[model samples]
Target: MLVVWDSTVNIYSCAVEGQEGLHSPVVCFQVKVTPQQFSAYKTLTCSTTCTLTGNPTYIWYKNGQIVTDNTSPYSVLPNAVDSYSCAVKGQEYLHSPAVCVQGQSCNRVTYTKRRICVLKGSTVDMSCTVGYYSTTSTFWFRSDKSTPEDLTRDPGYTGRVKHTGTYKGPFILRISGLIEEDSAEYRFTFKTYNFEWGHSFPGTTLSVTGLQVKVTPAAEGQKTLTCSTTCTLTDNPTYIWYKNGQNVQDNSSPMYSISSEDADSYYCAVKGHNGLSSPAVYGPKTTVSVSPSGEIVEGSSVTLTCSSDANPPVQSYTWWYKKNGGDYQSMTGPHHVFNQIQSSDSGEYYCEAQNEMGTDWSRTINMDVKYDPKSTSVSVSPSGEIVEGSSVTLTCSSDANPPVDKYTWYKKNGASLTGSEKTYNFTTISSEDRGEYYCGAENKYGHLNSSSVSVDVQYDPKNTSVSVSPSGDIVEGSSVTLTCSSDANPPVDKYTWYFQNKTFQNGFGQMYNISKFKSKDNGHYHCEAWNGRGSMNSTALMISLPGKQTSVMNAAVGIIVVVLVLILCLSGLMWFRKKASKSTSDTRHTADNGQGDSSPVYDNISGMAMNPTAAQTAATDDQDDVHYASVHFSRAKYEEVPLYSNVQLPQPQKQDEDFQYAAVKFNLPSAAPK
Candidate 1:
């Protein structure tokens, strides 16, 4: 049995009838296609040999329908494209494999698809041509799909394609509003009118280019940067320009604006590529400074040093000067020297140094020249006045380059010397030490003498007045004082006190004191004092014993005796009465008897007148004129009785109280012979 099947046929079979009654030697046959069926188009045809065997009947099916009267060793219609298969009916063992037909042409030409570049938001035309086509149906395919899918049917490409002339023999395709993803490989198909067709594979590379923005400056101008790229574009490429790592906008072509200060790092970039690499950076600055130059005095020496902290540090220094002398000159070195400096050597001066980077100037120095001297001076201590016997010091001061070597002491009396000891001291000063003194400072240059200092030695008392401590009439051992003072050339040395007529000397009297006063102590006391010059003495004062005041008491007794004699003689009338009474009684009793009684009466009257108011006159008893005479006789007898008794009288008898006194008559004593 034999059978054939092409790729167009999905199934095929054969039927047997009246087989149920058959008894002996009966066989049924069937054929199946392996790997289905295969096909070929155009100049392709089926083979004469079949894959089926055993010489039996065959059947073919098309699209799930049966076909009769199809017989051949292979299949019907050889050299034609078909969808048919074959089956075999046999007595035994019937199965056949399916086969496919491939085609080849004598002259085959591949069609080339056209691609183009366009600006953003523009249409893209894609046209292609193939060498072979007959009644070809043209179609488009996209390369992004696994099985070349139709690109005309994709929504992203809607309204984006316009087939020029109904997709004729050489197809022309256009895509409008083309997106970035639309730019890829596409395959175009042309179907012939009688089922013959041609296909082509085409590819397009998409790129976008931006406007060039060149930031370059003109010659002799600031530095500038630029940005640029290539022409044809499908998807718009993003631009990212950088300046020192910062984003920038560069819209103008061949001219991007920037400032002179913006000369630092610069570059440009595109979205699909790495950062830019065009512009370069610049550095290292320079500046200039202006300064004054020269010295403060004309022609004076001055130095100035200039330096800078620059990239290539300063190398050489130069001095540019307006002569402090009013001229201009140039010189080298940092210092300028002028010998035997003059007044013209004073002015303003400065300096400058130069390097590959820049130059700098220094500050000005003003110098002046003059003269001053150094020497020593002399001075005195206790400056003003000089007194005698008082200590004094004279000092000399001086200043020299190498210092002074010697000090000389000099006297006004032509005495001079050089040594560390410039002073002379006198212990027991005399009038000789009171003179003018001068001093000098001596080195190599001879001597200089200071002014003289004249001293006056004065002599004033040390103890002016001497005193005895116990006050008036001081006794021995009572401690007396002696002080001596004088306004003398020198001072007092010792004190000497004198007692009596002797310079007091003993175990007791040291100066003005004595332990005991003997009889020899009562005399004038004097004190004397002396120094080197002379002596002085105080006035003498006598000293005596404490109780010797008797001469004052004897003068008081003689004044009492002269007062007693004057009181006794004051009573003269008592004496006169006693004398006159005796005379009158003698005459009246005896001698007047022959004469008249007148003589007796006359004597009585005279006695009464003489002793007026006498006691005897009051005692008499008679009141007669003769009674006056008796009073005379009684008074005469009382007066005539002697104060002292011549002879002794007898003792009188006792009487009573009534007895009266009688007048006594007595004889007168005779006168004494002369």
Candidate 2:
């Protein structure tokens, strides 16, 4: 995921110095960048450590190509990822270490210091933030200057390339007994658990240089001095002279002459390198100054000159301008003349004097200037047809000598002052607020008025309602009208009718005419009023169609039939259940009795009974299991009566046991209903 940048204005560009150790101390070229956060943008600056005399020219390059020519502390926007390096124009062979910066994001890498200058034969460590998620192994390698080999295994770096960190980094790569060849673009690489990431960026450049001086005797008991580097540099750069730990006024050539110089330090550097000075040698000091010092006004003419005191007199001088809030501008000459000055030219001014020893700066001086504002105008936002109930704004502007003090607003033709502010705001606009409006601006010198502006306000239809003609249910094929009405400024343009059947009928005007309305059209209806500004919808109006009478009749008949069927079914179910339950219970009751059915069976003789005991109207128990028929003959039909002897069982004792079986008497039930 990419990180969102806040609103800030930051441009990333920088100038670093590189030299062939000519008059300058030989060292690797590198730009060290620092991030500064501002309201506008985020930026990175690249700085370098190089020894040079007078103001040396600087050239900035990106990925080995010249991008800009500027002095040290140049800025580059950290808006994206890019590699950069820099060099002295004349000594193009030496380039500062290149650095690539990636903003805060996945696999984002950044180096604290992009370049380092170390003396030859000294140990040094280079490090950077190698961003990786998982387990990662970091390795160090140089660009084309060296192969992509583990420093521990590469024959050249073996034993000398110290691995100070494991797989995890910000891991440091340490080098021991560094040689001149070690001066190259060093980058760090690493592998994540799932993938490998490598980009050409954020590489450290190392510069190695050794200082040496040649002294020779001159005539008249004087001595001549020359400052040089051990290695032969690319271009033969003029030497920069410095005395007693400060830059000398003379800045040119490696030779310096002294008659009685003692107890002061002296050094030299190549042009473009003012950082690494040769070993300090006992010598005299020099102080540089401008002829006329202190403040000056704009458009004023002034003469500025540079002077210095060294073993050899100052050779030349270069004037430089420093704006109050801007970068330095260089002008070469022994003396600088300003025929005319402007407010933009107001700031500090100084000069650079150079000799064989080194280069130095003079005390700074200051300048100032003045100006004001002139015309006025007004503007409106959203320039078009204005809608009622919407907000609107009018803004006023003016130019002046000193600046504008305040703004006033007014309504044209009305002759009334509206407000006393630069901007006129309307929270909710209405027709009354519309008119020709203008504004006036006043400053220290004078005041001016702006031209008039016009405004229009529009609104929508209001209080819309729907009504049906005849206001009652109409039979099929009858003509019906639905009219939409509302109160609006321009009147309703059209009316749209919607029916309860969920259908929209094509319509226009106020009245919706429905000719030959049928059953399908039987539903509630509503209409909408529309105008140029907006629209409004009305309440529903019900419309009745023919054939609704039969509908009620059919519905009632269906309900009646359904009720009858339900009643009949319920009765049948109850009857079946009751009959089944009674039959089952009767059978079970009879079986539980053990004596079988209790119904009696009687016998009726055509004449009177002959032996009452044998044919007595009685129920008897016997082993034969006999059954008797019911005596149902009418008593009136029988007249004669016979007497019978009492006949008991042959053995009374055995009779008790035989009586256990009971005789079944068949009885006649009552006659059925006719």
Q: Pick the candidate with the highest TM-score.
A: 2
Misplaced by over 4 Å in model 1 are: 1-115, 166-168, 193-200, 203-674
Best by lDDT: 2
What would the per-residue lDDT of candidate 1 be over residues 327-382, giving only the tens digit for each residue? 65678764455544554454555667654323566665444433221244445455
Q: TM-score per candidate, in order?
A: 0.20, 0.25
Q: Over the stretch 123-218, how does candidate 2's per-residue lDDT look in tens digits?
A: 677777644354367677776644477767879887788766664466687887767788776777677676554434436666666555555567
Residue 111, candidate 2: alpha-carbon lDDT: 56
| Model 2 lDDT on a 0 to 1 scale | 0.58
Roughly what TM-score does model 1 have, to 2 decimal places? 0.20
> What lDDT does candidate 2 reach at residue 337?
69
Residue 179 in candidate 2, Cα distance off native in Å: 62
**Local lDDT at 244 for model 2:** 65
Q: What lDDT score goes with residue 604 in model 1? A: 25
**Alpha-carbon RMSD of each model:** 37.5, 42.5
